[model samples]
Target: MILILVKLFQGLYVSNSGEPWVEEAELIRRAQAGDPAAFDLLVERITPYLYRVVRRLASDQNEAGAIVQEAWLRAWRARHRYVADRPLSPWLVRIAVNVARDLWRKKAPLDFADLGGEEIVLPDPVPGPEDQLTRKEALERLVRGVKKLRPEYRMVIALRYDAGLSYKDIASALEIPLNTVRTHLRRAKSVLRLWMEAEDG
Candidate 1:
């Protein structure tokens, strides 16, 4: 029996190694076996990507951080239901995005005075003398346009562009139909393009 169990585990490992290293799949396997260490690994691996997506959805850094922390806790509690054969990242991201949306809705309406903090603090904004003003203006316009997007459209766009998720993955993460993902992306692009053109004009 011992030898059989060892062989079975070895085979499982080999099969898993041959497959893709998606976040959900690995976490499911480890979590199913009650491995806390694997859960931690999953969190660390997805944190940076999740942070960017959450940040894009949130109005500010503080809110984004709070949402992300809540998302992780949610993921932890839900780990028992995770299916090991599926990709874990999308499942985790789906939860995170939902949490972000909830926080966005729960936030108090912003006051007009809150708009006073308009200065961007990115490092090295001017790389060269040529095209500096044009590049800066374009980037600012893009940020403004993104910020103005509706929550659903912004979430999908951020997941696609900022978090680098495929359409299928985004669909899975957002718990929406694949066709809806395509629709949202299409609408988001049209709106962003119009916004960018208006800014340019």
Candidate 2:
């Protein structure tokens, strides 16, 4: 199965002009019908986005990769339960997050202190060496602050910013209410701001 999945992933960019690519909904429908190729296509398209979501919770690249693969396997098994009309990303993200959470439980205590793989890019209106240096420093501080956040806050932050998920999508992914998502984000930002301010002082 792993070899097949790896081959399908490698073939993602292979030209298939002979056949037009199917729409995502159709792909999902086909996958639900147990079409392996359709499911592989879904995996190819969704893995990058899902990895970003998983990386935020993972300790390192290898763990992140494992989490993503396990999530895909679980997704394949649960495809029949997936609602075809609903968007696929949030559902997949939820699975990935849960997988990471379960791994955390089995390992040592969950610690966000080392969650530092994703690059943070800040746009500068006036681009220069000095501006670039400042942005880099700010990004470093922000990442440090994020590492200090509670597990739930870190999850929301990862889902909202790294994964680029909407509030509703984040709520769905985390199995929480929309208001709870908003509250966590708000509180997270506030804590980060306070942490940064204290650092400056």
Candidate 3:
């Protein structure tokens, strides 16, 4: 899967460290071939973003950290299944999202009321705690409403909206048909819109 999961990501694999964009295809190829250094290189590039993504899905910071580590472990273990031409971040994210979902499912279906806690990194670039606090309370209702969706729906939301991945990228990450990604996005948007409107009322 194409791994350009987040729009605001900081890439360690970029030709220039401070450069936002990176060409990771070769790096992905090497990593897929069981090169530990390659894999480490790839992981180092994505670790912070990976943790943030999991932090949004999981309950607490600690759980998020654990989920991030497990995600890399799972990704490495399943490296043979990777499609190198595709972006690696999405695949890594899919694993992390599923891992978080599985854990959440084991405890409980993620409920609307339970969506609030520490502020999750959203698509927008909020500066810090001061910037986040205002949005946090306002967004909690939106997030909780989103949590009311099916896991599949939420998956799309996280990947497409939160991670800022494209529909094609999401399909690759989810390993589903491209049409399925379209359908999921359509349906999830419809559901979320309706849910949000209701919340507004």
Worst 10 residues of 3 by lDDT: 1-10
- List the global CA lDDT of all models: 0.69, 0.79, 0.68
Tens digit of per-residue lDDT, candidate 2, span 1-201? 355445544554553568777899999999999999888778877877887777677766678778889999999999999998788988898998888778877866534332222233456646788888888888889987776777788789999889899998988888899998877787777777767778989
Ranking by TM-score: 2, 1, 3
What's model 1's overall lDDT? Answer: 0.69
Model 2 — which ten-residue stretch has the worst lDDT? Answer: 112-121
lDDT by residue (tens digit), candidate 1, 122-171: 33556686668867777777777777877888888888988789998888
Model 3, span 1-201: residue lDDT tens: 124322223332343356454357766777778787667667767877677666556556667767777788899889889877666777789899778777777775634322222223334648888778857865886677566776666777777776888888878777789888777667666666666667669
TM-score of 2: 0.79
Q: How does residue 137 of candidate 2 score in lDDT?
A: 89
lDDT for 57 (candidate 2): 71
Worst 10 residues of 1 by lDDT: 111-120
How close to the true structure is residue 118 of candidate 3, measured as C-alpha lDDT? Answer: 28
Q: After superposition, how far is residue 113 of candidate 1 from its true place, in Å?
A: 25
Clashing pairs in 3: 1-87, 2-87, 3-87, 3-88, 3-89, 3-90
Which scores greater on lDDT, model 2 or model 3?
A: 2
